[model samples]
Target: MANVAAILGDVVEGDRIFSPTSLHLPEFLPAEAVVYPTTEAELAAVMACAHQHRWRVVPTGSGSKLAWGGIGAGVDLIVSTARLNQVIDHAVGDMTLTAQAGAKLADLAPLLAQHNQFLAVDPAYPDRATLGGIVATADTGSLRQRYGGLRDMLIGISFVRYDGQVAKAGGRVVKNVAGYDLMKLLTGSYGTLGVIAQLTFRLYPRQEASKTVVATGTADAVAALAGELRRSPLTPVSFDLLSPALANALGYGEQFAVLARFQSIAAGVDEQVQALSALVGASLTHQILGDDEDENIWAAAGKALFPQPEAAGQTVLAKVGLPSDRAIAWLAQLPSGSLARIHASSGLGTVRWAATTAEDVEKLRFTVADLSRAGVEGTSGYLTLLEAPLSLKQSVDVWGYGGNALSVMKALKAQFDPGNSLSPGRFVGGL
Candidate 1:
């Protein structure tokens, strides 16, 4: 195996080579490697070299979400898919599209909608995020409320293992569940599990009509409404709770936005709308928002996660999951003095929080770590975004805690790429 400089050639510009980490200014990157491959053949060549030498490999999509997982323990050669972007297939009638990992969502969304259908699982940063990155990171935003997250929408995936073997799982048939759901197994596993090269997902008809009903209030009140809205027959794509202040940022003065998304034949909307009204509190009244309105309010509230005062200056952002009811109250336990922003699924279960600085992240680490040791804290599971300072990497326990499934995760990683060459310490349990 050649030295990193020799093997990567021009792709390895000494010292000048940069990573997606700086975009968010993350704290740590354990390995020191970068490799850009223009084709699958080049990817294979690079993988062959890394595998032979037992070098940790980090495969990248758009790098739009490098902050999603723990910092790469150390990158031996950043096998970037930036150059491998291509739409291999767009089977409209089949409602299936296939593309290289580096293909951007901005590129895919409009294309999918051309056939009156769309890839429903999209985050706010659709323009910069790639299909593979989003899946590897398992990211989805407000729209996820309606269509479900990537794990549910993903139908098939093809990737390169650490040992350079190309493998695939799942199939294009939207309804088929022929075997173990390897595609889902990889979802939310971070990049440690596999390097997603191409993916196929079931799409939904582009929403014909949608609306957001802003319901403003306190956290407890919002929690109650969140439950009510979720249980109602309104069929909301999602109902997100915004802080009174967050609501104001979106011009909703102290009111939490209960964005109830709807999709159906035109006539039923009136019935759903009426049903929602009956379910909400008497104190709450909605300001009906249309496409532009729905777009502006939630866009600011949903994707505005990064700017959250708590998470803004920090180098990490984490998405956490717990029983739906207790999410709001958990915010009280965030690192002291940390500026953070949070979004809870209508059920109060899944939440995403972005912490501002590396120091604040340390606060988060200990907080979650303590809870883990004690066992049965409010935060059941979490995904780290060590996208901050390198120093914080050592001080803080980045991946807060784990469940009984971690042993299984490590075993699977070993089984898939026994070399331990793919995203070594970047995933949960340092797989």
Candidate 2:
């Protein structure tokens, strides 16, 4: 502790250094102390000190997702980017923006909206999730159907290496193809590689109007509509498949549902809505939501996968990916009380439920294994236990990644963090 204080000098005096007891962090993160670095240089210095002492450090922003991923063996210190919140620049003409990693997505919304532009991502907990945290977790929501993943919107990034050196990749421009693609590599690295410092993203213009069409019916009927919409010429910003539990929560009946959102000029949005309505016809019950109703529905959808603050301790949240055509079948296999929202086109989505005991969660894992075995040929399903109790996490692998690239991932981890000092074992395959 004295050594770290000496290394930081007056920069970390007074309340800047926090005892582990003061914060409500996860049990896996047994941090001795947490430090807030106000600048990139300060962050680098902290990392350097940790490197010299061989201290295991965990990097975080607002600690919104600190409980996610596999539990690391040990943690000596926590490096937080909360104090580094700053928007460096907004290149409106080029439709690009650069901001410190600690900047909250919610705060950036109105700022970007001033110019009729947005970051084109719908990550979880916008008010508390930071730019760096979102990129690190890769929590982009259904918006990926139209705007793509965070890796596509991220044009540039700067991060502090394990050895405390500042490094950068990509650039401020959207067309830069120079050097290695670290942006993609670090986007979902879960802080195992380094601590994200700053980020640059390509922005998109806000549409003039928006409408959401929700159609509810049997799984087969909804799947058929999803297939038809995918083959049609209409463009939807979000195309999602809602499980019976989730649909019921959103005021739809206890049936599988397909929800699509279209955003464009008023006439274009109306035209597409009419086209989709025609396709839906009398075969399935459907509704067109606009204005406040449309916005409220989507907001509620994002919140559905997360437990309320009071229920956070008893809830479990997991992400699942499978063949697009098999999503309905997979949803049908989930536990009775579970709520799920899977992307109809990409087959990636979250499943959440409340469990009073670890045994309940273990049963869910068994169900996942059965579904993986039943998947289509050449395509296996996988699930990641994103948020859960420490007991459940310790019993099961958080990231159920059974892929062939693990050896390569281990090699990269060894190269980037030879000491395994940065968020050790929190990433895939415990890299």
Candidate 3:
């Protein structure tokens, strides 16, 4: 550690480098040091040093979603993008913004709001979540139903390879080169491909008005309404099916409810709200939410999506993916007390429940396995435990299945990080 610090002179701080004990990093992966870089050049220098030493490096941003992905096998250095945070450009006319990778969405959001534009992706922990972390994790929230996720919003990226080569793909403009497609390759790679330095994303104009319509019914009925909304002309920015537990948590009287968010001109929003209410009709009671009420409900739902317990072992969270049409059926398969918030249109869902006993861990393992088997047998689904007790993590494969893409993923990893210096084993198929 001292040798690398000395090599970088005063640029690297010895105090910041330490073992990975603070963040929710894999307990099994022992990190020798954590280096903080304020600039891309410094990041490249550190990575080059690590590569020369053959030390495995794990690039991180805020450590918010560090525990995601497979278990890291030999992580020696933690390269953090803490101080490299800045809004490099905001071409409002072009509806695009470029920011340093470490810039938190929380900070960037307010700036964009000033210009009547905003990034569409909405992940949890916005206050602490950095742009690089969000992109690396490919995290998205309910807003994805309307604007799509990070993959769609991102237009350009700059990254430092394991060998310290700085590379970029795409550009500030919407149109770009055709080959490589590095933007898509690195977006959700969990930082295994390269250390993301800067990102350029297309922005959306803030809607003139917004409203959320809430409706309650049985799972089948809620699914039917969700299906109807998809087929109808009503354009909701977010269409979510809330679990009974989650619905109750959000202060809804019913156990199951559908929350639809509309954003457009005031008149259009009003029309969509009325049409949505009529679609539910007598089958379910509906309510058009005031701005305050709408914010409160969506805020609660976001918290539920990434629940943080007051104490350890209080909750276990997992992400599930299924066919949009089979979401209800899949929800029915979960054990009672399990709570979920699902994107009705995307078929992506997140499940959470209290972790009270060893039995619960076993049940979770079984559930993940069952979902994996279903995907294999043509049901087309997947389940991944995102947060859990260390004991529970050790007991099962958090990533249920890798599928046939495992080989190709492995080949890509070998080509990009043959030295295994970039987030080793912290990827699909343990790449």
List the RMSD of every prediction in angstroms: 4.4, 2.0, 2.7
**Model 3: CA > 4 A from native:** 1-26, 309-312, 355-377
lDDT of 2 at 22: 56
Between 1 and 3, whose TM-score is larger?
3
Per-model CA lDDT versus the true structure: 0.63, 0.86, 0.80
Q: Candidate 1 regions off by >4 Å?
A: 9-27, 30-33, 178-180, 307-311, 331-386
Q: Write the per-residue lDDT of candidate 3 for residues 186-253, one digit (tens) a residue.
A: 97898899999999999999999899999987887887888899899888999888887778777876
Can you give the lDDT of residue 294 in candidate 1? 66
Return the TM-score for each candidate structure. 0.84, 0.95, 0.92
Better of 1 and 3 by lDDT: 3
CA RMSD (A), model 2: 2.0
Writing each residue's lDDT as its tens digit, candidate 1 over 19-89 gives 43433323354345555566666666667767877777777675656655566566665666766679888
For candidate 2, the clash count comes to: 0
**By descending lDDT, how would the candidates be arranged?**
2, 3, 1
Residue 96 error, candidate 1, Å: 1.1
